[model samples]
Target: MANLNLTQNGNFSSLAPIIPAAGDDNGRSTLIFLGTGCSSAVPNAMCLIQPSDPPCAVCSQSLFVPPEKNPNYRCNTSLLIDYCQSDANRSYILIDVGKTFREQVLRWFTLYKIPRVDSIVLTHEHADAVLGLDDIRAVQPFSPSNDIDPTPIYLTEFAMESLAVKFPYLVQKKLKEGQEVRRVAQLEWKIIEGNHEKSFVASGLKFVPLPVIHGEDYICLGFLFGEKCRVAYISDVSRFPASIEYVISKDGVGQVDLLILDTLYKTGSHNVHLCLPQTLEALKRIRPKQALLIGMTHQFDHHKDNEFLAEWSKREGIQVQLAHDGLRVPIDL
Candidate 1:
């Protein structure tokens, strides 16, 4: 049985889970913080720059901020996890490809000097997350000097179903002649038999898929990586389950190293994402060394919230940082 307990409101935690011992595999794991803002992104005014008869009020307000403060403020919410460098490696496993994925990818290319993009692992097929699929094609055959080739995308069954419905052309392999080039790997939740929690080995990384509640649907999956340095990314989840303990607890070791999660609400009740109190409740139980909040919207000010959360996280003995674009955290495997 797991040590963590799920409250009536659905939160769970225990000791700080230790990073599990790595297998004999020698490949390393690297995480690139692509974007950390919500769908609107930072400098929310960018969203209004689209050709419109009247600009969005939100964007107008966002533009009022001093240019000195945020010269190029934009949403930051996507992350690219590159495991091994190979054609089938799916070198780029993205968490969420928001509306800014194009901008983020271009910026990442300029900043990281990327050569090619392999695949993307989508969280949920929300507009902010899925709209960037077209942008990915722009870089594919991604070689600047020469065409690299097309890319593949890995998504859960629900996410795949949703995306196919939204962008049929993207996933439609049989739609038309010569349109079968788009590649997609449909993921089915493996029912854990015996000691194994539903897991799949991809790109030399162990992907432990955990169930999370997204409103009435239990279709969302938060992920746990590696044996020990687990990261639970529940961006659009409303509730956490005790079963998640199985993913965090690594071979009798303790909890995850970090929890990059959603705090979509400030104080009011939300049936989609965890509010602040609910997030804290989960933090106490997960007991991660650090907890960074992502998927933030224009309603919250980054600097103000960062200062407040920092103090709160200190009191709770957990380092807290607000995610931003181009934040890279490299884990020594």
Candidate 2:
């Protein structure tokens, strides 16, 4: 159940829309919803709701959200942000290359015609979020003739330490003087640069790191992009701080246009992730024109969940959408 009391009459005129590279020349920014399902994406233990049951009722006519327990439900975690090819300096900045990185990269290359990834901004060091790092080798130049080269992988100093601990082979020094693996070679590391609090530009986009509590043992990051269109990707966040809220609402540089938040637990309470009710409460504070919930787990049937959310959002005057693999959202800037 969601509390939908979003204000629609506010002046968004001060905020310029994100224009995707496609369509009109007004410079609209585009957001492609890739990998909406949470870590236990379809077919996983949590998502495969109808292993033996019939098709989903709501998603029967049109397969918008994944049907209850459909085997086709994919991975829950993944996302890529492409700054349309407007500015010459604009390059593709990837957020959290999940276990499905190879698949996501191929899809992006085919759909967006991207030959090279400019940079990768990691959200955390979770396995599902960073496992696909090996796949970056595919995009690196294999031949000298190839023009585009390997992209830099960016992370916080703490995250890099965590990655080294988790994937020691990738970070291990040459044991016997043998050549390093091609995958390891593709990795060019850069620390997320800036004073701890202020916003900084890494890759091509302006990124502001909003540190949030993830669990007892670790801290997680949610990023705010651009001056007008603020996308706070807070997947594992348990609570929202006043500073975070102020940045997204009337107090900061601009109003949040889109919030891609985590809705992992709908009914239960996780010490780390934000529950559905909690997410809705945050929405009231930020009041973005549109909000998309990501990192969905199997407990939520896509269609039923979305239908419920849509109806609820309408009542609250907030526009909302559940993200999915290959779902392209264009923002007009």
Candidate 3:
């Protein structure tokens, strides 16, 4: 199983949340889960508002300790891929800076000593994904003496249209006459087609867009990205189209090194997200060497669910587990 192989080796363990010292990522790329919960996130506010007699085990446990110590405490789904180029340029490519992006930065960014965000890619225009773009300046701060360079933002035309309506200033900055530029986010919107065959470069790494259907008709994008290790990420997906399924399946591009997928619940159905059974089917078909499920709701108790995954991993011969906030896994690519 992946967990057994994980503990015995240091290659790719989903449970390893070891914080790297500044400038010491151990000479390899890293994949950090800034947040691993669904749009509502774990510890749902409605769960507490409409108090149950027994209360929610996951939400209740979430408050028992600080976020760092509580895997049950989760935020909007987000990921950070940090890597260094052959030119020694360290890049931080953030995927979907969500509503909780600032809070995540306060907690994980400081811990990881990430200097700045080199680029950003929006999965779609969902509020959970793009609401945090207003705070881009924090990731790459400008000084009083110099003008800040514009950070590149990659998105689909549909996503760009949404952002234009949501935050016009971000898509195109408006400077007043004779008004000095103060501290503000300088952003460069780069629109791209979310086609499976089309690949785009962010900073130094190449990313193949894995466009998947999100509810019934809505299209959301996931990505197959890696510089050294082949990592495929699909944070929000309901069902994979036949073509997409083939793209990630063992018979298609062959098994990926790591697969980060979405699982909205332990069982049952979600109009816009995959359930546990669906996730299992995906793991079996993709047959990734290791897998980590994200975009969870409050129904899952972190420790308990992870134990189940470990057992399931053993039975299935794939290392898969429930990922939590602040979880850091090492990746070669």
lDDT per residue for candidate 2 within 17-68, as digits (tens), equals 3422234334445555546665645445422343335653323423464332
Backbone clash total, candidate 1? 19
All candidates' TM-scores? 0.72, 0.78, 0.91
- lDDT for 195 in candidate 2 is 28
Tens digit of lDDT per residue, candidate 3, span 1-333? 225222321223333223223334566778889999988877899777887888877787755677788888999999998876776668999999899999999999998888889999989999999999988878776665337788898999999998889987666566668866566577888988899899999988899999999998899999998745678899999989989878877788666777899999998988999989999998998898778889999887877887888899889888788877887776567
Off by more than 4 A, model 2? 1-28, 46-72, 85-90, 143-150, 172-185, 193-196, 251-254
Compared with the true structure, model 1 gives a TM-score of 0.72
TM-score of 2: 0.78
Better of 1 and 2 by TM-score: 2
Error of 3 at 165 (Å): 0.5
Model 3 spans > 4 angstroms off: 2-25, 143-146, 176-182
Instruction: Flag the better candidate by TM-score, 2 or 3.
Output: 3
Error of 2 at 306 (Å): 2.1
Instruction: Write the number of the candidate with greater lDDT, choosing between 1 and 2.
Output: 2
Clash counts for the predictions, in order: 19, 28, 2
* Cα lDDT, model 2, residue 215: 76
- List model 1 lDDT by residue over 1-333, tens digit each: 123221222122322233212222245455666766666665565456672466544345455863223413546467777665433343656666677777776666666666656556566678877787766666564343322434555566667667767776555434465543443322222122112265765445666666677686655667767554667666777886556654554322466777788776557658777777787777777777766677666556555666787677767777665655555454432
Poorly placed runs, candidate 1 (over 4 Å): 1-29, 44-76, 84-90, 142-150, 174-196, 249-253
